[model samples]
Target: MAKAPGFVSLKEILTTFKISRRTAFNWLKTINQQLQAQKLDQVVNIPRYGYKLTDRTKKSLTQKIAKVSSPQMGHETILNAHERQTEIILLLLDQEHYLSINQLAKMFHCSRNTIIKDFKALKRHFPALKIGSSRLGHRIISDENSIRLTVYELLLRQDKLVYAFINRLNYSFSQAKELVIKAQQQLHMSFSENSLQQLTYLLLFTKWRITHNQTIDRSENWQWIAQNTKDVLPTCTKLLGKLGGNKELKGEIVFLSKIFLCSQATEVDCINKNLYHDINNIAQEIIFRYEQLTEQQISYRVFTKTLCNHLYATFFRVKFGIPFSSSEVDEIKWQYPVLIKFTAIACAPLEHYLQKKLPSEEVALICLYFGSVNNREYREFTESDKLKRALLAEVLVVCSSGIGTSAMLYHELSKTYPLIKFSLPLEIRDLAKIFQHNYQAKLIISTTILPKGKYPIPAVKVKAVLTKHDQTIIDSFLRQEVPRKLEHNASAVNSLVSIINEYADVKDEKGLRLSLDKFIFPGLQKNNKADLPTLSNLLPAKHIKVLRKKDQLKWQTVLKWGCNLLEQDEIIDQFYFEKIVQLINRYGPYMLIANNIFLAHAAPSNSNKKVGLSLILLDQPLEICSRGESAWVTCMFVLSPGKEKEHEKALEQLVDIVRNQENINRLLKAKSPQEVRQFLLSFY
Candidate 1:
């Protein structure tokens, strides 16, 4: 109280004077009364905080605050920019109220302009270091957790004054080191040299925060804070209690337990029984999303199980904060930038579920898990799988019957020909629109005879009324119209070879010819580079639109706009758009795959001639309400997986492009469609 009259915690006051709370409060009351009688500013009590002294009050009480604040290096050592910025951060953490520019300049032996520059430069690294004029002068309001993490980081780099910071406040610096080392040895065979020191400092720093009335919000992550720390909670409880902590409060202990979760050795196989199940569920989803994005299935045994345990361990480490150093991270980032980006997208739901952002090292670590297993090691499709692909065969169910009958017929035929895509029954007059748009449809089963010159697509006349003869006719028509070959001419393959030769020197013309024939020829190799559609192939400049808030578009409106782009290219029929709407209405906004990015699609429709992908970037978000969930959508991607799931490659590329908020911002800020297209081209 005599040397430094900044805000000090009640615990520190009581501990220093060896007094109870009541005694401390009574002393504060008396001190305030005496100061008020003298017409001087008294110590102010801030709820959730202990006490702070105003400069006028300190000046009035000439006996108090005898010494001015000094730097860690005293008057001898002048700090460089980086060192001074870090020192400034440390100094702010000491003051309860604002420290003026003049005071700071005096303490650091610098000019006001130098301090201002330091403020600006420090903010570049520590964005949370808020600098603003308040009651009297410019003071920083830095987050406690962030500042402590900064301290931990400083300690990591062997900052000498880090310990002085803890000691200056007369805070407890317990030997939690011996305890942590003992517990870690019980679980791990060998540990890193500084692991004990890091864990010890983390626990003590947390205890220091608790003592100073700066505690973690217990109610924030109550679910994880409650159940996920059972194994380590008791140990942490004993350790904290031994170091003069409030034994009744378990919040600090719970936080320490989470730290313990992230500290296991690489060779350890310990599965945190409580956290593993949740982590496993997240792992399953990431794998599924990864498969969908890449359009290739990953086996569950090695990849799935490994990712689950790895994520379980890494989750807490990332959440709590760990700086990882890996040379491979840089190389992997440079070499497979797209893969890392896609992996992050796939891991997005996990991050959302946990409500925490993962660091790049964690993301890169997951990429290594994907890289180990993702060399086109796709699951071999069985005969049944091939049949399922053929099942995209569409049939136009034409009926002159009313709406009620059409509804009944649609479901009945759907169940009857489970493999076929039976379009909802349309009136005979509706046949023209269907024929014009859905020319890829193989057959039209009509309740009444169509006009002779009405359409080029073949039709079968079936009775509107139920009959055994009608079923036979429908059965005979679909069996013959089972999905036909891809139908590529010799010239198509020759042109492809010539294009490849033109751009790249063909070292193996004969080998390249064989590969091209297989890629082009039906059923030979659907996954070939030539066959798998990508964003570059599907979404041209014409297909992308920059929408705005002024348009006042709804979810369905932008959905239609995306569909219209594909429809213009004849990649999909109008019915495909209708199908997406119907399915979304029936199910939910499953189309909103990630935050603000809507991947609008439905099951493949064989009637669509080619795979289509289109984008609509809204300057403002559109709220999508459905039968289930509701979400705001920023970007809507319309994908028509025509006849096959070939659009997956395109979807994968789109995920890579927009998964990051930064990239989305960059794309949205583009002035023209050509700029947007060129931006996309850069990724490929």
Candidate 2:
């Protein structure tokens, strides 16, 4: 029949007061009516259990009980744990002297054990506040800033409680608001209404604390605040001085400056020249790095200005260890791994300047800035448009030697049939490899022999240079192979072109197409049906070569020997070997694809005659550096693809092998070239 801590069952109340069930029910109805009249929540009843009062309802009822209580009543009111805790905190803040646990127990009409438990619970919420018993008695110990933050948290939790406390201290809220307005006007900055309210409450609380002979310990970085926020510091100092002079004015100044810096307010010329320059430089660098990775341009002016404004607020949060909440960080990271990675790398300088490593959430916020800008360039395509592009036949143009001739043919063909997406020009020998990797290519137009039976896609032989007759043959072939339904709408394409021209400074149609293609489909465009080529097909036994190291050899010599093996096999011309050497010298051995394994090859050029692979296992390991990454080379593969770009598939397979430590270990441990080839072919 006893009442529970925060609730009392109707049965219990009836039994304890010796009342009838009907009377108890009627009393509950009256209480509900009164609560409703006061605009507070009524008690909720569980079907099988009892009536329960919410925390708000309990607090309201407790306040009403306290208001009507008198000493002549001869009975004390009971306070719940939350009410007791709030009372304890207010009491500690108001009094200069400490109150012992026994004294607090008598004051709350609770046992010392309950008071100790309340203090324990309160400590968890305010980590910065030290609550313990000393020779003097129990007291709350914390730095001024910690106390201020705790007060802010308390104010946020129960506004009525805070207002009551402030009212007791005779702090004028209206006067505080006036001081905040004066500060804003003097600093030439405007704060949001919410910010203004928060500042007013903070100033009022600070004045009350200082006047009660309780001064906060100075822990703020005044020097840093003065240097970085010189423009706003004077106004903040004046406002704090007006509230309460020099007792804790320095800490007050630091706190107010933080508010100004972090407020979601817009101000013209709020950022100083040096800080503006630094933020701008960092923003530009980030955008440039993003462009390099994506191969798409973004509007730098607007993005930089917006980023600078964000950083101004973020700088304060980072410097002062303020918590930043970003709920979408995980989702953004999952959706845009490449963007996040590049952004993190590009923001290294900002991180260093801030002297704090950015949390993933903060980095994800930065990604959003770039994403918003890029979204305007490449709006989400319609599902039908996506399907049309997906079904379009990818055509590869094979032209004779001469970059100029190949480029000219590519442009002409692309212009003639805008609907058909074409690959950059490839040589006839490279066609098979290019087709294997680019399974999306359903047709090939070659200027030389078709290399019959080498490709799965159909091939059309044309003159080294285009002619009117060749154009007719291409048009006839396209009619039969490419479905007419897959063609893009001319109007839609032109509209997209116009949109791009309006937003971007593209000089011509070719530039526009290239940019649009890159923006739409980043990385290499691939078909879902494109399967990775098997290792056996890419590295035949005849192509595998092993070398026995006689004494020691330089890393360059090791690379040269592998290239020579491919050249001697007639897989590539001498020019290919020279090109490979030139590549290594200029770019280093970045071609060392895996641990102790190097796959060296050059772009498909005139030097490459046919697709070829040569593997050389060094008896002695040679250390080589490639693209700033170093690897010990014990096994090397020299790939030469005829003008057909055969190396793409082989390179992809090699990367997979390198990624698998087990496969790389097995290959390195193989005794002979035949064993290495067998191990690689196991993947098939």
Candidate 3:
């Protein structure tokens, strides 16, 4: 049979191991560090500068390959270690005649002392083997075919023990503990204080082995002669006795544990054995069945099937339970189809549980608490109801036009505001369909009225150009300070519309707010739904009613809350940064990006005249994204450098006006950014 395929690419490695690039890099670094620390034969003659395993090292690694329980593994082994070790040894022996110890030592890159010890051990195990002295100064030993096979079996057993040892250390603490518990239970043994303490020491010792390459001395093995040893020491001594003393220590448990602890390695040997064995066997079967196929076709068919089988077993175990086995393994082996089918089956549970775990549904339920101030009962935004509230920052936009200009505009907006998703293809004829096609869109913005004239969507209209009047309208969209009661007066709506229409040319914050205030009536009439009117509204045109929405106390609270969530003395992790981006996405229609600052404003459905603070992230630019079910999150805002007064003032105005503690608390609680925007729009 053709030799098994080598690791093809980094992408293949990542997929096989189910590790991120960051994680894979770390593992590679760890391996390099281990190689350097061991002072093993200097790494040489490799394609890249990565550490190279010497022949002995290759043997060691091949032994580890068999254990599929390590965190580094994402597949199952189809062959046992014995079959693999036998094949490798047979290939090696067949390539050379009467190999000498010195030659083997040179290949393995070990000292004569190690080779002598290994030869001595082999001789003791196979007493019938003949030894010969050569004039060429080579130490020779004889092994007939049966003896070679017998030694291969022993090597396979040793490899299995070593693989198990490494796997126990690398997977999880719980897994290691479980193995210990199961062993103890099966043996029906109870540990004394000393034995228990020894186990703890063993755990630490194992950890040290992986981190620092070191070897354990024979004295470090479990002690039987020491009086301090307790809990059936005699039984342990007797068992060790049967396994043989230092001269014949084949697959000793205490020694195996020490090696794994010191090496910080895993059972790759077992995996290599199984993987190769399956490749060989599967290839033979395919070649036998398909008599006319080319070599490439046969190889591809076998390779693909092997990959599929591995995925099926791995994902099956992950989805159901660890330490799992089914009698149906034979059936699966015969009928397994493609890798995609395995992935779908494996991901089912993770996806199912994730949907249930999201806080979006609860946040949606909270939106119900906000009944229309005018008793109009405007429908709240709906979609992604099952996701958690924290994920709401991603928005899908919906518009009347088909996927032409509006969709193009949505893509442009996405570049400026990466947190939000848009549904503006204009392909969606109605708001409900927009919600259905992209439930993840938190709020909707449209250039035209809803075709049905009644929209469940929290819809807002944006002028083509952003003028001063348009700023007022956009400003109203940012503040939930407007009331639905304004719908009763056409003059109020007309005046608000005119002011918004007039300011379509102004983009400045001052110009934006000034033109926007023309639409608000501070003391004209007070309804229970209206927030405390701004001081400017109460004082009328003669006197400005200047109100500070965010005071010193609120700022302090925000800083403290931010610190707590970030959980670091310095900057928080990037996940929180991504969340802030999602927040912006849910709230605003038009946003201005100046370095780190993000500003957005959208109007309410009941009264298009009122606007609310759509969203803002001022502390820092978002630099992280989190994956969520039923959503693709690109919500991150990065602050750049510029110290201009206008920039600072604009940023402060946006933060102070748009992100007060009350508003933030509500926004943060919103199931999606759309909901947050709608809640803000409701204020208008």
Candidate 4:
């Protein structure tokens, strides 16, 4: 058959030149320009075909190609040293057998001296390989493992060379790829892009080694493998069977099982008995500590199960020295210091089991788990709900059933009537007493009917299951009563301003009254409170403890002791200690506001109903992770506050103390809680 006219598709040009569509079009335009300059026919595009060059245009292009190939223009075509070395490495790696100097010179179209120099360069780059002249040829000799690793590195450095490496294996990757896809489907999990690439390379490497009659020495911890990898053994067996199973396949299976175990699997069931027990115990302790610190109950079963699976994979990676990376460690530390700190403490047992300290990246991973758990629990209360809650007026809820119906009503009312703050459920009989006690209570919602004229507060009766009508009634009541409550607050503030003006000379009485009005009626305030509450007011003598005798204490012990003081004083719930430690673990010792002062805290929760401060002055300085600062921490200030608004004043006051080095010095010198309180009072 006669050859078809020389033609090239736009897609083919793009793939060949590695250029974009526009560039390809521009090249064709340039070619047409050159042909026009020569006063010959231009390249023509045929519909449903590609660009076709006329016989005359082809002859002109051939002459142009010859001109560009001249010695003066040939510098542009020459490969750089790095590029040449990469090509040589690929050539060596892809070859079925070693190549002689004369053969490489022929392939590279270079001199014998040039080929020898390239070989010398390759030998330097890959010291593990023995590159020297042999009886047969100049060859690269290395163990299968070393050669595979070098090839993998080359592929990583040049991703475009992946297909080249695969082709050189003389083994199709389709079967291995199918095996992975099937395993992922069967296991109910998916591998990450990086993981899939690693697996593909591994399969190809394994096949090459097996075909070459090369075997890897057993280096995995067999005991650990026997106990924990039983679940993945079947999958590994199937994979090896397809790869043409051999006598040394068990070592490869063990290796493959480890890789599968370290994957981000949804669940991990088979674990070493001792490791499982240790992980469970550690998880329980961590949850317990977290609960005590936050004073919030976490779903134990769900948290433990998720944590156990994650730790199992972590344990495997740590044991086998498998590298792991996380870009979110710093972000997690900054955002969830308390949770990460708690996670770190929880991870202590695992560290002991691994016989090494856990890296910050691993600790950050654990923090992510806790952060997820916390997010799931509080997913309902969004940012808008928080804003609306601040504007809501307090209302008493009366239910004869106590918590059950009242709690439901509270959540429902919170969503429906965003302007109402429903109090905890109270008995119908306690309505009169509640009315007398709660001056802010604007209206009362009741599940049961109440007697008329029984209390001064307005009452609305509704069914346990609120209907649209009930919502309308409650919404209507809030619309009328909320504004009236604001007016009442303004009037009270006006009265207080009048009293204050009588006692002092006031030039700006109007301005003073406006300020007082804004302060009294929080809704009227333009700016949130900027000043921190006085440290003396927040930290009482009862919550402070002074350690007079010198005693060595672990950083964990210091956190627990401070937390114990806060818990004893009813400043925080039990888990607050773990939260404090978690914060330290996540963010390091950045909380050390001064030379000796350590300010420990967590996010506000119900456990901290009121702002509480505990001061623990150690007799001797203790070591802590300071992110490269001095680790001698002598004074620990544990602050547990119920809400951000409630503690804003206290934190401001604390910051002032922290900023002043003189105050910190005085605080360190204080021998007793009374002394510390006295010194803090001096600032107020």
The TM-score leader among the candidates is: 1
User: Measured by TM-score, how close is model 4 to the native structure?
Assistant: 0.43
The whole-model lDDT of each prediction reads 0.64, 0.63, 0.33, 0.61
Q: Write the per-residue lDDT of candidate 3 for residues 1-684, one digit (tens) a residue.
A: 001233235565455544445544544554556556655443333354323445544544433322222211233332222232222233232343454556544443333444454445545644444444464433324433223223322332233433343344444545444444443443343332222323433443344342442322343334421232222233333333432333233223344332222111101122234433543453333222221111112234323333323332232223222122112223322322221122222222323332432122111111111111112111122333323221332333443321122323354334333323333333233444444443444344544444454654355554221234433653355344223432433455556656766767645645545444433533233223233233222212211111123332332233233323223322233343344344444422112222222222111122122211112222222332223312211111222112111122222333343324565544434544444344544553
What's each prediction's clash count? 0, 8, 81, 12
**Model 4 worst lDDT window (10 residues):** 65-74
- Provide TM-scores for the models: 0.45, 0.42, 0.16, 0.43
lDDT of model 2 at position 505? 82
Model 1 over residues 1-684: C-alpha lDDT tens digits? 434546678988765644346645655775677678888777777877768778777766655322223476453443445666777777776667877878877775445666777777767755544666775986655555455556665654445566556555554445667767666654442233334455676666676677788765442443564565443555666766876677666656655565566642323333356565777778887876676455556756645665665675577777655454332356556645766777877787678777887778678667756654532222233434423332333777675422222333454455455445655555565555555442456787775557776677788875433346667877777667772322234566788988998899999998888887766542333245456877888878998998755667778888898999989888888888888788678756655555788887766546476787888888887888886568788778887774556765776677766767888778777766677788988899
Residue 616, candidate 3: Cα error in Å is 22
Choose 1 or 4, whichever is better by lDDT. Answer: 1
- Expressed as tens digits, the lDDT of each residue in 335-410 for candidate 4 is 5454555556545446656798777767776666555543232234444443333224378766542222234455
Error of 4 at 229 (Å): 3.5
